[model samples]
Target: MPRARVVINREFCKGCALCTYACPRGILVISRDFNSRGYYPVMVTDEEQCAGCGFCAQVCPDVAIAVYRE
Candidate 1:
């Protein structure tokens, strides 16, 4: 299986948690650091575990996540 890389545009994230819930691998998490918008952004806990399913990107209303398979 190809490894996945998940990138979250922290500046655009709104702390919605939709991506976290959408991730089947449970690799997405809300970070403690706040972006310029004062919102907690999502982070990929383990890119190696990602399935590249794009569920997070699909559910993100802000369109902040990008998933790539390698």
Candidate 2:
């Protein structure tokens, strides 16, 4: 299986948890660090666990997540 990489646009994110909930691999988590907008962004805990399913990106209302398969 190809490896998956998730890129999050922290500046565009609004600290929503939809992506985190939609990730089947449980790799996405809300980070303690805030972005320039003062909103906590989501981070990938384990990129190796990602399945390249794009569920997180699909559910993200902010369109802040970009998933790539490698």
Tens digits of per-residue lDDT for model 1, 32-64: 999998999999888878889999999999999
Please, what is the whole-model Cα lDDT of each candidate in the order they appear?
0.91, 0.90
- Candidate 1 least-lDDT 10 residues: 1-10
TM-score of 1: 0.94
Clash pairs, model 2 backbone: none
What TM-score do all the candidates reach, one by one?
Answer: 0.94, 0.93
Best-fitting candidate, scored by TM-score: 1
Model 1, position 45: C-alpha lDDT score: 82
Candidate 1 lDDT at 12 equals: 94
Candidate 2 residue-pair clash tally: 0
